[model samples]
Target: MVSRTTEARTPPPPSLWHHRAFRLFWAADSVSQFGTYIGNTILPLVAATTLAATPFEMGLLSAAETAGYLLIGLPAGVWVSRVRQRRLMRHANTVRALLLCTVPVAWWYGLLTAPQMIVVALLCSVCAVLFDVAYQSHLPVLVGRDQLLEGNARLQSSQSLAQITGPGAGGTLVQLAGPAYPVLGTALGYLTAALLLRRIRDPDPPAPADSPRVPLLTEIREGLRYTARTRTLRAITACTATANFFNGVLSAVQVLFLTSTLALTDAAVGAVLGVLGMGGLVGAVCAHRVVRRLGQARAVWLVPLATFPSLLLVPLAGRGVLLAPALAGLFITGFGTVVYNVAQVSYRQVICPEAMLARVNATVRFLGFGALTLGALLGGGLGELVGIRPTLWIAAAGTSLAALWVVGSPLRGMRDFGCRAGGADRPWS
Candidate 1:
């Protein structure tokens, strides 16, 4: 058996930015995030503009990106658990970089198709899931459990900044070139990230043995069982799942609400939507402080409740200046979500055993992200059945009630889980 000390060969850093391994990860992550944001925006734009896809095709594109989360979430955890996290991350980025490069090449040949974009989205989302689970697991190795909150907060801020900057950059690229052209930037970003990741020199755990021929389903079940039985994991997963469901409902309708309901020009709508990114930046900035002031455990539940009511503004949203109400609600939601995510995610990282960290993250992503997929379908279906405004009201109502999932759990009453809070009980079965 590998000794514990050998597994964690590098000591935790005092400050992430100054630490060599952490800095490389951070730079790589920032570039990847910017690229992801660009793809997130530009992908749909390409479908609408270059492909001139109908509503059905556009919705299919949306589903393609999230499809991997529902399809490969569990198996990904199992796979990541058996591999070295850093190596997996590097390999995944490399594959994604190569895959994205194909998009522009196809476009350059005047052969890019909607179906091709869908395939690209599907493959990219799968690689993203693989990298993400490993990426979260690797952070605790580099930064230590105590610093997880700070680490996540800094990372969130960078991501929020990317969200703010990426759309504008992608739009600029599309305007200067064409919609398919922005994909080249995403390819370059992934390549840069792979190079940055290669610079890290942390001690890698040994590779998984081919002789250990365990059934894949049995391995996947291990993570599912652990998540199903852990109280905190189950609660947080449920809360996120429910929240994403309602958020999905809004996502399907929000675009129509802005253009049709609010009558805002596309330019004005983009400006208003930028408020959402600013809100996320503010939340990322305030996440650690909010946790400090509210106590980590209580902050998780409190922030959600505080922000839940604000979502009603979306239903009440009107035309022109009246859009302020919905924008304010988005700002509040952004702030509350970042604060809650930082506290809860740090808690998850600290309390999980090092060996199971990747599994736990993957399991949580499976449940929480699966909710988003179902929610989008629900939103589109419901919007068609009733009206968009009624759908918005229903979605907001559902969101207001999602906080109940965490409130009844152990997470509500505690201050912190501590470094070793449930260390002995890492596996539930």
Candidate 2:
């Protein structure tokens, strides 16, 4: 009954489900994440249970998994910009799958060793560095900037879901069969993800033929300066880096604490971790609502402040009823951390220049993950010297303090972030 002009006004926004390319990307990313989570759980269990590794070896193994992020992160960003993101991601996954395949193969032949596992982890880390940079950079091209929040939210929710199911499945498999089966499953997952990625019909456009070439170091330095000059990015990076450092410490000792201190079985450990990961699922689902209620800027700093202090309970966990404290602490920490990640990642993506996005992301990750590697080593050494509980206490207390970086920074005063390329702080809407 209405006129055409009147009816056409203010049409509804397009849904991501209707976007075929995004659907493909989501499927690939989800599959890859699910496998990665399984690997994360099973690899550590292999080192601890199958190999009977010491505390320092556990820490060393943990550090190896993330070492590539610190070692090759910066250069990977520049490389990602030069290639077709989809192809790169596919290749990276394929390489990772092959590397992971070696683990179970060696184990079957009765040739598996701790050093070989560490080597596989290290090589996979390099591939992960490349794949991650390509993945994050490819999103804007696959879906428009307007759909970023929804796209990111959906992706994060899937990742959280994987965090819950992956560990449980891996642990259950390890208990029922052995570590080799889960390791094989992880390899298959990566191969499947690679195949899915190859099916993306709409791939990233080729670079311009006339685009000016620059030296690699020059490009790297430019990204560094850009991030350093941006007040919001700098503050966010500092907080994230600090948190990762302590998180590394926590991760290095978490399994040890659960298996040794509490004397939980492998299956029980996975179940506990899976239960704790439910918090991330809840947080990812509620992230948009939280941002709407609290404003994005407030959500970033305020959520961490509210939830991170709960980690103090982790060191207090023991047998029987005492385990409740650790469970509560991990759940609360996961919730806050996921919410903060969704908000901050969307903000950075919105504001960064399209050409510079990969570099900026890499720069942030380099610092954050570098700290993680150091923290892992520290956690291992401290667990041996002082004790597991004391290390946990130190890690928890340090993580709680990380929020202070943003609390006093310029971001505290802003409601949301502006979309300008260089450090401009204004309300987005």
- Give the least accurate 10-residue stretch of model 1, judged by summed lDDT: 418-427
Q: How many backbone clashes does candidate 1 have?
A: 0
lDDT of each: 0.77, 0.86
Q: TM-score of the candidate numbered 1?
A: 0.88
Error of 1 at 310 (Å): 1.9
Residue-wise lDDT of candidate 1 within 226-254, one digit each (tens)?
Answer: 78887777888899999988877776666
Best candidate (score: TM-score)? 2
**Each prediction's TM-score against the native?**
0.88, 0.95
**Clash pairs detected, candidate 1:** none
Clashing pairs in 2: none
Model 2 TM-score, all chains together: 0.95
